[model samples]
Target: MRCSTPVPAESDKLKLDWTQWIWPGPKRVFSAIEMARAGQQPWPKSIDYYVYSNVFVLLAINSNVLARGLMHWAALLGLGLSWLALWVAKTLWREPTRRRLNLSSLATAAVMIGAALLLKFHPFGLGPDLERDDRKALTLIIVAVVTLAMISWFFLVLIRSQQIAGRLRELDEQALHLKLARRLASAQIQPHFLFNTLASVQHWVDTQDPRAASTLRSFTSYLRATLPMFERESLNLTEELQIVRSYLEVMQARLGTRLQWQIEVGAGVDESLWLLPPGLLLTLVENAVGHGIEPSLRGGSIMVMVTARPAEGQVLIEVRDDGAGLAAGAQDGVGLTNSRERLQLLYGERAHLTLTPLSPGCLARLQIQTLEPTA
Candidate 1:
């Protein structure tokens, strides 16, 4: 049977949004696209297209070649006026939504329609009076048709712009989730480290430290407590502490009674808080055991302390082990090296885990910058 990995008791805050049952992502994008189309302004090229389809062509079909020439000139003149009017109207009404695009089309459509209306009813429109009322009527009808076409075109352009914007937003959200998952995975499992743990514990069957044998049992417990609670992206302090406890139990077998452990947690540092990076505390605990506790052949105690600094809105954790301490050459140390890299990736400069040696032992202090206040 395939094993179903269980998530740790990190924070309940990381739960799926149980509050609002929102629309699916694609549908939301579709709605945004539709809205953008409704709200967007027109482009200048759209104006040109509208003018070509509406005013110029109507003049082309309904008038004499000479009258059409004058109307074409008038339409060009009106197009400039329309361009200016649209720029002003959009500024006063639509604001900068279409600030960059060519929106001269809106003005062109407006001006051409107005001119067409005037030309249709006015007796002396654009040229000498038409010989027949029928000719004038047909000319008027054509101008009206162009005016309608220009308005319809502008709305269509707005609708298309909205659809494009919605799709872009959807893609952006998807990209963000992929990036978060990548970072989470990189921070979690360390195969070589796991292999080393078994080897290191087994290397000594009956060494002076009788505790080494029992460490195997502690390792087993640590694995049982930690592996089951591992979540995809994050975990709470409560879950992390369980991993730490099991690890410390196994480590006590190596250090024997020489290693004493203490944990002091302040109030309001809630278990459900989502602050620390996954496997961060593991690295800290491991480094304490590896470089701090194991080196002092006489054995030493490790104090894992945690406190809430509500004034600063941060959580401070200290892992102190009374061992030989870290060497200056410890820069090559893998546990601290990997721990620091993981911290930088997850919290940038906001979160920090540092290894410093005391006269008695080495101390790994971790400061989580943000406190997701318990609700």
Candidate 2:
């Protein structure tokens, strides 16, 4: 008579199938948030996952085999051992020598392979082979390929994260350089403005003009407003307009009927919420008087129109003059250049300054995005 092969009981087969099916649902619930914050990849976790998952896959392939309880315990033992290697890899991977290719990961894979072999061949001398030859070969190939792919994925994540960190540092350095350029440009212009204002005051006092006291008072107000522009970073539309009014008042006294101006505000504009770079309006007005009006034989009118669009969160500022717009091939002066640099530093592309020719003269239009804090 031929020797008969021993078989697993029906209860054992049911127990193994139920355990494999149920293990996956609860196992996937580990904290992904905590893993990200901790700077950990899911590679090791995947190794732990496959420790149990491989058994299920193997059982599916060999339907005639019944997985013993001891086999499950041995797989858990391998998972615990593989975790030791994963911890070692994580610790050493931080070092420069181990960053690209960590040997500890290879050791982890070796432990997982050993666990698969034990599952296929009964451990502790329990019994004959429960799995068929074809199923065993296929299961080993699947486990090995998955293990290698996970190791490669871990290294790719590390390299990409390092590249991101480097790029962020470069952006921060560029921002600092822009800030320094803005401060330097603003500082150089303040002294030149002060000297010119003083020279005008002396011109009136020395010539013994009867309007000296009134001129002195206007100068005082202009000085008080203009002095702060050198130090301030931003000003609201209302405060800036007041300062510009003081400046124009001083100029009107000097120019008499030769200088005529207008300041019109658009409806529904809340000056308190609208912001502008310091002295931006002053720069445009000064350019109008100096470049446009001063060159004309009879002088000209300077019109400053300020309109705010609350719906769009923008402020439109225009300074126009009736003097000769611009001579052929004229370039931006220091004042206009300084204003442009300040706008770039403060608002990047959100603010702009343009000098366009009005029929006879020039129109300086400045459009800036408003920054109003929420209520």
Per-model C-alpha RMSD: 13.7, 18.4
Best by lDDT: 2
lDDT of 1 by residue, 240-294 (tens): 7877887777655544587777676777677677555566777777766667766
Stretches of candidate 1 off by over 4 Å are 1-115, 122-221, 228-231, 332-335, 371-375
lDDT of 1: 0.60
Tens-place lDDT per residue, model 2, 1-375, is 899888998987767445433221111111344234333433345654764565556545544343554445434443444455355544533321233333444555675677677656654544456345433543554475447545544554455355434545565677677556555654543455456656777887898876667867877877777666655677788888887787787777777888899899888778887667778788888888887887887888999998876666778889999986788888998878878988877788889899998777899998887555333
lDDT of each: 0.60, 0.65
| Residue 145 of model 1, lDDT score | 49
What TM-score does candidate 1 reach? 0.53
In model 1, the worst 10-residue window by lDDT is 20-29
